[model samples]
Target: MGEKQPNEQLATWFVRSGWSKGELARQVNRRARQIGASHISTDTSRVRRWLDGESPREPIPKILSDLFSERFGSLVTIEDLGLKAVPNLAPGSGVDLPWNGSQTVQLISDYSRSDLMLNRRGFLGTSLALTAGSALIEPMQRWLAPAPASGGLPTGALATARGGRPPTGRISPPELALLESTVRMFRQWDAQNGGGLRRKAVVGQLHEVCDLLQETYPADVTRRLFQTTAQLAHLAGWMSYDIGMHPSAQKYYVLALHAAKEAGDRPFGALILSDMCRQMIHLNRSSDALELVHLAQYGSRDTATARTSALMHALEARAYANLGEVNKCYRAARLAEDSFTDISVPLEQEPDWITFFSEAELNAENAHSYRDLSYHAGRSEVYALQAQPVMERAVELFAQDPDHQRSYALNLIGMSSVHLLQKQPEEAAASAQQALEIAIRIRSERVNTRVRKTTAAATDEFRGVAEVIELRDRVKQELPEYTRNQAV
Candidate 1:
């Protein structure tokens, strides 16, 4: 037996009018239909099998050849059908185009489409770090710190509508339709499942909508849409981070931040900043994360919502905990708790974004913060127990709507980590394994990273167990290179 070459298959098809196997199958089915053959059928899977060198069932192969010959007005053989292979027929391996205006448009369109496809499942498997290298970052840095705007929006007209949609009109029909669709979709998914399943799609769709809005709407209308879109994008990015597409996720976060600024929503901007900082903490860049938290605090100062303030403080506590600054972590955690004291006030007083925050939610966050501090302080028992209840609550809340895969994944990771700390190796392994399965299904790097960390810790406690060792090894193999280093 020998390996079959792809080019050989492609070449066979080239001489027969360059029709692909799938195309040939369609032709065969069509010809069969003309002949009044009963039960005529063709499918991608069968065509793919033929392309892989399997012989066709019966009259199908000859029928396909005849159909192609008739269509092309010449003799067509199976060999000429290029069924074996072709020299340059690799999927997604097209030649690169020159960077220009046209290319940029194509890039944006293709990227959007790719994102849409990928979001339907999990994070796109490809790494964005290589693509978003220093080259991209340098320009982005320059743009972020542009000299005082000369009577222009911070990001220039990038945020404004170019001619696509008028900025005013009592919620134009199309705009209302779009808004309702987005809200309904998001709420439905959030309620039914969790963020894991819908986060990527939500974000990708929001980005696409934002792109369209920028191309069409007026400033005021665009700004409002942009704000909501940015929030969706932020959630998508968070889900991406949760699932494990750090590079692309970071890009989305940055874009969301810019969108938030354009909408003149400082609170939302601060919230995103806090989220970005949390990612840094996960990466062990605690010092850098601390700085980001400070920035978030500064940006959110004038925010009227107690929940928003509490969220910022909670983020600060996470950074401090990561830094091993127990006192600072406690102080920040306490600030977060105090902020929630006024959360019971009138709903109108709270910001739209922070309206989801409640006393139970704040308590859950506090519990997690304490657990983080405990981890840094080497108080395993206390950390394990303190984190248990809140983690349980999160799981319960998230499970109420199974579609929120991202939140479910996060809670699972947290619970797994706590179980590991309690030296419950079996329970820890089970939790970690479940999380890993979800992570793999969604192709999320963040969830994988968390699972890897927890599994490694658990493995140390059950070094002699074969199942534990095997699971640990599998997790180690699955984690990204960057995460492996951080876990160590």
Candidate 2:
């Protein structure tokens, strides 16, 4: 050839992946989105240009390294692409786990520092591939293999333990108790308010907790303190996801998992995995979600309480529903239902976090599982018929708890959508209006989004029937102000 190709490495991967230039471009665009890139316009021409001697920019090269690394089972970097690299940069290896107490704490502390100080885009861009084999799998595998000891302090933890920095006092039980109560309060607020509004405060709270973790504590103190910290991090990660800050959510969840491992609490670790399943399911990564759900159940087999195990199985049902595996969904659902036989024990014995795993909550989860099948499996008629009754049951169960106004509201919305799928316009309108009333009162984007889904449903099915028209108009008219109130 008169001139050798500039990106022979990329070309080789393109061929090996059997991807067209357009396909490669598409993959890169999706990769860009994983890091919150909103304006990328990568296309076939971009790929061709890259292969024609034009080097990619700072993030693209880093992004491609992740893409090809996942694809080819090897680390492929900017230099590998035969392109001039960004000055003094190489592909980053992701979180390595299985370290003893010292290393694990250091890993999380360093992550928070980088998280707080680094450019948000670049920081998120690097960690987007946590789902890739190396980042998530290895750490989870290490955690699952053997539980570490319960209360080992980090190196020099004792010497640094005396200063309290939030407003300098030592990390004491009262301090730990305050964090616990704060997380508990946030949980109730999350139900009433939703994750979007509360996520920033939760993130800041987690930063404070991480600061406390840098200092040393005695064994019993470390155990309880770290466990509480893990819970706080999980809450922060969860709220981050609800706000749609997905990469940041992933970061906090990874930190939570590390802290949970350090706390030597297998059950809580399982719970963190279960919490992660929610984000994974929302992202449409059902395969990964399924893996996580099973991991949650298996990892906590010995330690997770019955209600907790039931919740894990229920989560598995949702993952299977996404995969269109109806039988598995029902099977896991039944196990979840069966796991709730004992419910009257002292709440303190179990993490108060699982308090939401009440009968109503399990029914709500089952309702979602059925709802998921109806939405995604193309067996809508059959599944919607099943989902309507389950959702109705969930509504009834929720009504038993006066404080459960949020889940009750959501379940009714779910029922309305199921009714619309089943072609019951009258029932759908009644349920939608009720849900709208709930949405009007709650400060939650999630509630509004659900109502909007019903609005879209009625609009799409336009028979110009008085009921459908009226319901659709009401939702559309109200949603604009409602969404503005919440999102803003």
Candidate 3:
């Protein structure tokens, strides 16, 4: 109906495939017949139209995805090809369901399949929209629904939901152990390097895990498998978020939550919700983030450890801070510190996934809270002064761990923000320079964004100072498009 613009993404894939337009049309028509779309017909003109920005009906996109995947010897998605599916073929359209159902597999499988092409789709100049905070709340509600009067949801529940597969050929213990170790390995890599490096590997393993879920296993093995799957999905989601692929990250987090539910791991599900809340806050949906953090705390009330509780409380503080509620934020921050001090269990006995929430991590969250409050709470110097000591402590702790280069860099930016508000131009520029160096090394858009944002703040605070000018020049060289004119 509108002016026809070229679909360069599809054109690029077509050119890479090295096939004539006629060759593609013939393959589509042939694949259509093979798939029983006998009434369908495609000619070279149809292919040309698609390249000219016309979306073909169903079956064509699927066929092309399959064909290109084969030709490329890797997974290719409809999104990677830049083709919109007909309404009936849309992903997850009718499959949203309760956590402990066959639909879990479908949801994970569909999402992972699409995510395999996530890195490739960037060139398409489009992306899936982020799921709203309210949409994520519904899944949390389902997760928090009361468990059966029995100790837990019955093992038969999983079996029945899985459509009663035969019990033989259960997954071996060694394979399950390997899967778990792989998850831990991936988690560490994500914490060290940014998500951009190994996100695809995580997504690829997740796809295979979904296939394994299709087979019946011993009840204990089933739960373990689901736990492993959930952990992998969560790591994949976090990685995606680290690299700024928000929609994909949200999808992976939701899948992780459902898988955690199936595994009956309430504490882990709450963690996923909190992470989702963190993402929402980063996207400027702090109001929604507040709701999500509340849901997380309530849902995990009985199951969460002291450290996990502290983590949730810190996130609550972050939400309140972003909302400019200084009193509430400070109160929540104290609660976090108190919760940390009250840890009854030994650090080594806590869940491996959450053990990373050490004193340093808490300080990092607290510093961000204070930094945000400095701006929004209308007492810039006062709150920034409050942030300075904690921010410095976080940077010092993170500096001892070279693996957490990204976190180290980001905290430096936060420190720089504090200094800028305190009218310390030299200190702000120094911290900004340190963070920029790290941002240039790490494969994280988040860090780059932090660098740009800090540079923007320095630009506003110091104006034309030679030191600020030099920082601007370096930032412009590294991020050419984000000059002084851009507000970041």
| The best candidate in terms of TM-score | 3
TM-score of model number 2? 0.73
Query: Candidate 1: global Cα-lDDT?
Result: 0.59
**Comparing 1 and 2 on lDDT, the stronger one:** 2
Q: What is the lDDT of residue 248 in candidate 3?
A: 65
lDDT of each: 0.59, 0.70, 0.78
> Mind giving the per-residue lDDT tens digits that candidate 2 earns over 1-488?
66645777777776787778897888777766655565767988888888876777757877777567545534455566675545432222354544565555565555555555542443442544335334465566566755433234322333333342231326666877887899888888777666756655665676677667666666557666677767877877776555444555676777777777767788888988898887777666788788777788888888888889889999999999988898999999999988887555766776778888777788878888988898786647888878777788888887676665677788888888888888888888888888888777766555676777676677678557688788878877876632111221
After superposing candidate 1 on the true structure, give the runs of residues whose Cα lies further than 4 Å from its correct spot. Answer: 1-127, 130-174, 180-184, 187-200, 214-219, 345-361, 378-409, 426-445, 464-488
Error of 2 at 313 (Å): 1.0
Residue pairs with backbone atoms closer than 3 Å in model 3 (clashes): none
Cα RMSD for candidates in order: 15.2, 7.5, 10.5
- lDDT-wise, the better of 1 and 3 is 3
Name the lDDT value of residue 295 in candidate 1. Answer: 72
lDDT of residue 393 for candidate 3:
98
Clashes per prediction?
43, 3, 0
TM-score order of candidates, top first: 3, 2, 1
lDDT by residue for model 1 (1-488), tens: 68654445534554446676677667667655543453769877777666665666545544555455435433344445554222323332222222122223233345456676643322232222312223333333322332234222323333333433343334575865677467556745543343445664575667566555535345556466657766766766665665445544565666666656656677887877777777766655677677776777776577636788888888788888777787888899889889877576686676545655555456556667767767787856876687788777876676564554655676677777777677777777777777776666553445565677667667767888676787788776765443211210
